[model samples]
Target: MLIAYARSLVYQEQAVRKALLELQNPRRKRAFGGTLTLGEFSLAPHLKTFFQGHPDVDFSLKIDNTKEVMSLLEEGILDFCLVEGLFPKEGYDVVLLKEVPFVLLVSPGHPLAKERKVSLEELFAYPLILREEGSGSRDIVEKALAERGYDIHGFQKIIEIGNISLMKRLTEEALGISFMYEDAARKELAENTLVQVAVKNLHLTREFNFVMMKNHLEKDEILGYAKEFQGFFAKEAGRF
Candidate 1:
């Protein structure tokens, strides 16, 4: 049985290994089984690599609003999930993975594209393309606007889109201005297809975290995976 477990771990071909490793009590080895939601902008690229490194896991993905992600966690449908937001409540545990800065994205020819710094009032003049209502990005943007005494009701035009790629495409076409993470807009910014507009005295940011029930915190398997993920992100974080 030990040999079989070793083979399973080597192949990384079964979620059983991950489940077994997470067990705090030997008898509880097979108790864990559920889906996990990984919420972020364009996570598919990274998730593919993550699963490849642990082929034994049988988890699936669900792309949904951050609110939905939290709701699912509360419903016990998701074993855990990564999200960009404040910690949910007292009963949960959150490991803050990273903090991302938000920046304005616009087409190359947009008037404010060349500006070094723009005030919140100046940004209000243009048509804004925002993420869906429950998005972490949206929450940060709304909070920033509120602090500046500006609200969605005062915008010239506000459009909501559910997908990040669509928001990028729309911004590139000069259809609207968008606020997005710097990492998400790296390629477009590099190719000169889009420009990042800085907001003066307005530093928008969000913290990404891995959240799970308190009960899972003591599980060795869960702890090991969390540590591995933390190390992976730590290396990546250094580059940015």
Candidate 2:
């Protein structure tokens, strides 16, 4: 059985393609091996719709940190990864997908929630909840703060959380404020569960990229999959 490990975003596309492939070659379905393993960040939702009709192939999902995912790729435990922040490593090939803005999120009733924008200096007055060190989100936040002369040591109060969902929940419950992708908090903001707090003159943005080891460059399946995924992202750029 041929296997491919990927991020959650490809689940729907995988299902659509698999069904079409099977339909066109029902008699010799065994010719092409079919199996997919998916791992994703906590923010990525389940992709059940994509796997509805393809039951022959094994599909497994695991929740792992970004560092773990990258390590798996290096060890050949995964075929590729769709993640943000990190640049391409020496042995890896990367395709830049899209850039996402990092913004502060707070509950609707929080004081800063009413402000159109707050500077990094002003944000220091409040407690901060952040992701673990290797996380893309954490890296972006640290860089943005450092450029403004706000070192980690200067943060008034800090709390570290490994899970993105938990960080959002804590922010909502007023445990502390956090910074995250604007899209990730869209629903919560619209529903009043959270509010976006702008940072004055600071545009903390990061690019989301797809990556695979260089050895996989010529593999037809991997290349085809990459192209399809990249096309999908290009089409959806405006929505994000």
- What is the Cα root-mean-square deviation between model 2 and the actual structure? 8.5
Please tell me which predicted candidate would have the highest TM-score against the true structure: 1
lDDT of each: 0.67, 0.63
Off by over 4 Å in 1: 1-45, 87-89
TM-score for candidate 2, please give it: 0.74
Per-candidate TM equals 0.79, 0.74
lDDT of 2 by residue, 23-57 (tens): 77644121111111112321233234323434553
Tell how far residue 197 is off in model 1, in angstroms: 1.0
Worst ten in a row by lDDT for model 2: 28-37
Off by over 4 Å in 2: 1-46, 49-57, 238-240
